[model samples]
Target chain A: MNEVLTLKNVTKSFHQKTAVDDISFTIGKGEVVAILGPNGAGKTTTISMILGLFKPSAGEVRIFNHLPQEKQVREKIGTMLQEVSVMPGLKVQEILELIRSYYPHPLPMSELISLTGLTGEELKTRAEKLSGGQKRRLSFALALAGNPELIIFDEPTVGMDISSRSRFWQTVDSFAAQGKTIIFSTHYLQEADDVADRILLFKDGTIVADGTPAQIKSQIAKPSVSFIVDPETSLEKLYLHTEIDDIYRKNNRVYVQSSNTDRVLELIFQEKLAVRDIQIERGKLEEVYEELTRGTKEAV
Target chain B: MKIFQMQCKMEIVRVLRNRYFVFWSLVMPILFYYIFTNVVNTNPQDEAAWQAHYLMSMTVFSVMGSSMMTLGIRMVQERLQGWSTFMRITPLSDSVYFAAQMVGQSVIHLFSITIIFIAGALINNIALTAIEWVMSGLWILLGSLPFLAIGTLIGLMKKVETAAGVSNVLYMVLAVSGGLWMPLEIMPKVMQNVAQWLPSYHYGNGVWEIVRGGAPEWKNILLLVTYLVLFMVLSKYIRRKQEVA
Candidate 1:
């Protein structure tokens, strides 16, 4: 099947500053793709272009084989923008009703009220009276209200407590389970690591890295080792000092990194190092993100 | 039609919930009308001309307050609060959104005018013929168009808070200049000239004159229509700037 969402060579600029440059990718139906990047990394800008909130300076974006400029195409998509600008006078229930009137087949209000986790008193209160987290939840509720096939969240869980964020991911997972397509944008790498099928990282207004969580981890500079040793034989000296790339010690725990592992293991056995505990450190998505942003050839 | 109705209903409900509606629509118009009526006494017995003058001023004042202050403030607030963003981006088209707003605000403005007109007749003892009353209502509706455009533009141009304040000042200034409170015949020439330029003046005069058994002239109607179209065009231009960028 054609990907549920696609952008081919999309570039968007604000004034003279290029916010999103020549970026292209696609996400299939039922797949959760995370757009991961730091501040000003064009993640939000990229999503805005997809939503048709802003016209792209270059290139085209399509959601479900239709441009957002088409009204019929918009009905197939739901969006929670980075900024929540809902009317303050509207209560959560009232807001839901208002949105419900627009789309012919909206999600049941009660179902959505619960899916968003809004409680009794909160549901009746005006939007301005809502707490920040409640506001975010309500915004998401509006996005989901129309029961569109595709939902795009722009940094949805920011400032939310861990529990709320976790609940949010569960909600997303359930949506994905039902074969709904999702595109999530967030700076929280851990969240992306947990939920994303594919994580696309943008830096300098262009996408620099795109891969699955496990695949991205493989790009880390070097493997690491950490252990507590009783006898202080310099690992560098014992291993011919050539395999050691870097060493850090604190609280009587030693951490070391190197590309070579054979010499290090030989030294560990020969010295009979009284190792309390040993762990081979596999690089995390965070480490790979750092490496990608460190003037990697891919970023350029 | 579905989108239009939905938008209109939403605008009506949203306006009903606004704090500014409490102050502008409910509180301020009645207060201003009561105070202005108190300052002048139109003898009921023989000086029917003076009574006519009093009734006209009061009715026109009601229209002035409802259309300018009420509509302008609400539009500006909707613009600033990002309420327009939701409506603006909707597939129904921005013109549909504006149509809904106009319909919603017209209903609201009419409601306020009715209540205030009743209070004027019963409580303030302003006299009017049934024909005159119907004519006044018609003129009031016609007078509302320019302010509707002005409010729309202001809402589109200014952020919410600034729009509210700007609209309030503009309303009051136009209310006074439009001769809603006093007789333009007795006012200084410059102020009269300024009043002539304001659409509120035509609405106030047309409604007030119609209420006093005078003819509703076409000049004010023409001027009001001209100003309304001009403001609508100006707002459309401003929106075009957003569209291109």
Candidate 2:
């Protein structure tokens, strides 16, 4: 696959502070990459640089072998920024039609409405009158209107409800199935884990970890077992087991963290511990992300 | 070209739908024209010339109000709402976007000119040849460029309320101080000196000359052009600074 986006040691600084430190990455055609980080971690800054909103203080960014700001290159890119930006006093169809006119080829208005889940009455409503989730849906529709080859979303699901978020992901999934390049920045770890083929974990002003979701989870390999137990049970006795790394109680449940789940289970059975609704789970991306970012912060 | 047309149509639709803008730009000018010509200056020795002058003044006022207030306030709102940033990332050219805005303002401006002219002819009995009418209208349209640039400059302000306040103050100052609301001869001598330096004064003088069936003063036209160029350059600089920040 061709390289749809390439960043070579790109850096962006605003006065005394650097928003994006030296960063380099490449996204191939049809790849779904998520930039995951907490607030002020430079995820938006990096996306801005890629979208040609700001020039990198150093190094270079190229999209489709051309500068991102070039008209030809921008024509092939669509974006739904963190900010809701629809024009006020214009009907939804009017705004969509205006945006659609900017591209050489665009999706039909009917198709766009259906894809974004905009209802019939919404077509005549003013852009400013839409609710938060509806506005997000409209923004998504605009992003897809251009029939772009690469779509960049910055916190695309920030204000959406559960059903809207699921619908949004389903739309994204369908778009990705068409082999289009997709890049999004988000703080939702599960969002990244669920949809992204690759994740770039950002900390401070740089990427701390970059890999598939499973690979990132494996970096913190300790598995955990937890279950509800009687509040009176003396779970403190399990702390003496050498194989169990840690034990804690919360509410009416006990949690055991161990490197080997088999040994922990054997010990639990031998001790005749009363447990119900037990669940054994591997390290989650959220835990791995916390450890990586927190660990780096302490190291500094 | 098609994109430009579509953008212009959208902008025009938005401005036309705004009740505040339409009332100020379209309705208020005609009201002011009627009150000033009929009530304030009822029995002038040269009724025809006096009526024509006020007509031209009100037309200039209307164009300035529409171009500056409508365009400036809308641009400020767009920036605050992130629409400007969205446009920056699109494939649309900046020139096309600005041209569309200017075209929309000019449409409202032309409407103001027509309504004020109709009020002047019907109620005040001001008469002019077809050629004089066309020339005066053309001069008024040309004189509006500086205000358009000024509106863009004001639009660069961070807050919509601040921009609106500043634009209102500037509008009143230009109208009164520039002698668009009254003749400089009737005002104090010091006021006339200050009026001579105002671009609005030069714009009013050029349009007034055309309304009186005379050629536009080259010096005043030149001054208006200079202010237009200066404001355009300053507006561009401010916009670039904003984008970088």
Scanning candidate 2 chain A in windows of ten residues, the lowest lDDT window is: A291-300
Candidate 1, superposed: residue stretches over 4 Å from native = A226-263, A267-279, A294-300, B38-82, B86-92, B124-127, B242-245
Task: Score candidate 2 by TM-score against the native.
Answer: 0.90
Per-model fnat list: 0.35, 0.80
Candidate 2, which CAPRI tier? high
Which residue pairs show backbone clashes in model 2?
none
Q: Against the hidden reference, what TM-scores do the models get?
A: 0.88, 0.90
lDDT of 1 by residue, B157-238 (tens): 4665676677778877887787776678779999998888778788777765675578868887898889988988998899
iRMSD (1 decimal) for each model: 2.5, 0.7
Alpha-carbon error at A97 in model 2, in Å?
Answer: 1.0
